[model samples]
Target: MKKDLNGKITRGTQRTLDAFFDAMTALLQTKPFADISVNELCERAGYPRATFYNYFEDRDDLLTYCWIALSQRADSADLASVESSRRVDVALDAMADLLESNTAMLHAVLAHNPPDGPLFASLHRFIEHNARQLMLTCVDRDRFDLPADLIADHYANTLLLVLDWAYLRGHTLTRAQLHDYVHTLLRGVE
Candidate 1:
């Protein structure tokens, strides 16, 4: 569902998108991403195959869109005015909340897709790409000694590592602790 000229997702489009997302999330809970099919998604979403194709190219495309949409919702904070050192803290808090809220789906998904699995690799790449873009926008280039791209990559890698530890490695830290640890780790970088 593409946005209109106002760049807002219309209610109808949002409903359609949410249905697909819910279907994808539910499917991921029961099986590996590879096992999911476009027809199955359409069946679960209560939409026709043509309707599914209207919004996405394939199941993989739907999966990617799911993460992108979820992350965009998580990143709703207006960080332009936030202090550079504190922005990541806020962002991590949002992400941690997102993870916590989707615990059931995540637990199920993680069970089938370990750190070395394709699903994890796909998510990692997606987050890294978005995180790098975010870092460039939020951080002041003059403050970092490293090149902007390098700094962005460093931050993205660090965020991914912390996320892996928090979620994929037995949940040693609570969501709050995860947020705090990431906040501390990123504080000195700015």
Candidate 2:
């Protein structure tokens, strides 16, 4: 949603955005994005194809927007505030919560195609960015054998794999289990 002179989203625009994401989420559950046509999306959302184009550059743009709508960035834990031992937990749990909350979207976006698509890369960057931020804020760099960036990448990629597994498992996994697994992975799982 773009801001006007006042930089605020009108309720009408907000509702349209909501309908678009909701429609995408529902469609993602049934088919791969490659197979879903724009017409299908517009039909599901009860919007005209012209309206879809007006709001999104293309299907990929719509997919990216759907993910953003699912998760917000500012919710990242203040590493300066959370305990060091718990800082990792806080960040990982917040991510796990986001995964659980957006299970269908995550699945749709990360479907077993190549992991090299623009949107997939964007998803990777999103995870790595959050991991890198938390690692820099909470880690004692002097204690690590590798660079923080490397460590964060390891953690982020592993977490993505775990999230994919959880999604495939029908989300039967508990959040507590997710916490333990990611903690081990974050610690480099030696």
Candidate 3:
């Protein structure tokens, strides 16, 4: 949604933005994010191509927005309210399920990108940042003397790689199974 001159989201922009989100999600179900174009998105949303520009700088930007929105919605599910290693495992199980639930969209968002692409970087940064925030609340002393950022980065990268590995292996791992593996591995930290 584009902001008005005053920089507030305009009254009608939310409607168009919702339409764009729905259209983009629909396209993501059938094609990779790279294959979806502004022309197709605009036609599907029944909005003009210029209208897409009024909001997003490009398709990548729109896809990033979608991913961010997914994380935001997942956040409201109370992942952070959990504590203790036991509850952490439960929280992770829920998180894994949430991520996997968006299977088609997640695959489309990740599959076409190189390791250094914006989407990968965005997800990496997002996971590391969120891990830092979670450590602030959930970790007492972080169990090691390393810089907090470094530990968080490593853990975040591990989580991401494990998830990627699971998907690469045809998703043979159940959500609970994945969560248990990650939790068991990280329990060594304490």
Candidate 4:
């Protein structure tokens, strides 16, 4: 009986979080983050004001959570397989797909009057972690004299730069085109 009650509570919490994310995504598309208020978010989420506070400290906190969730979704889609030469291709495709799927939300966030610092930081961390993992997998330590940490850092920065450029340029490249571009950029950098 107690376990059943706990499960119900957990399910309700998950539903609330889902509602919050959906509402926030919609709100971000329509207005800058600064203009969005707790009341608006609560109303859009169809949850009480108190329920919003129970889950998040404020709008920024909720935005950070949303960013993290996006990262996790990307990571899971891109990195669930074993590392190989094909990993880069998989990741590039996943990134392009993410951009395509979240076009409106991304456009809103990217074009926000004032950039969201926490969201950018979260995205940076996600890219860095994945880039480091890819570097460690693809670079041969014995053949290349570069330090692993340096290689990781370089790849991470390069990956973020590529992503920023694509976003700023409005994702002009198709998925296949971006895949080829990434492969070309990363080919001999061991």
lDDT of 4 at 189: 71
Of the candidates shown, which would achieve the greatest lDDT relative to the real structure? Answer: 1
Q: Write the per-residue lDDT of candidate 1 for residues 2-24, one digit (tens) a residue.
A: 32324777788889889999999
Clashing pairs in 1: none
Q: Which stretches of candidate 4 lie over 4 Å from their true place?
A: 1-9, 75-83, 108-143
Best by TM-score: 1
By the TM-score metric, which is better: model 1 or model 4?
A: 1
**Order of quality (TM-score):** 1, 4, 3, 2
Candidate 2 global lDDT: 0.69
Which scores greater on lDDT, model 1 or model 2?
Answer: 1
The sequence of per-residue lDDT tens digits that candidate 3 reaches over residues 1-190 is 2434235655588678777888988886676566788999999989999899988888877766666556656633344466545545554554576677777766664556544665566666666566556544554444578776665555555566666567633567876678877776776665
lDDT of 4 by residue, 1-190 (tens): 1112233457777788789888988887777667899999999999999998888888877876676556556634434354555655666666556666787777787666333354556566666776677655665456558786776676566666676667645557666666666667766773
Model 3: residues with Cα > 4 Å off, grouped in runs: 1-11, 75-81, 104-137
Give the Cα error of residue 88 in candidate 2, in Å: 1.6
> lDDT tens digits, residues 137-181, model 2?
666566678776776666666767666556544556777877777
Better model by lDDT: candidate 1 vs candidate 4:
1
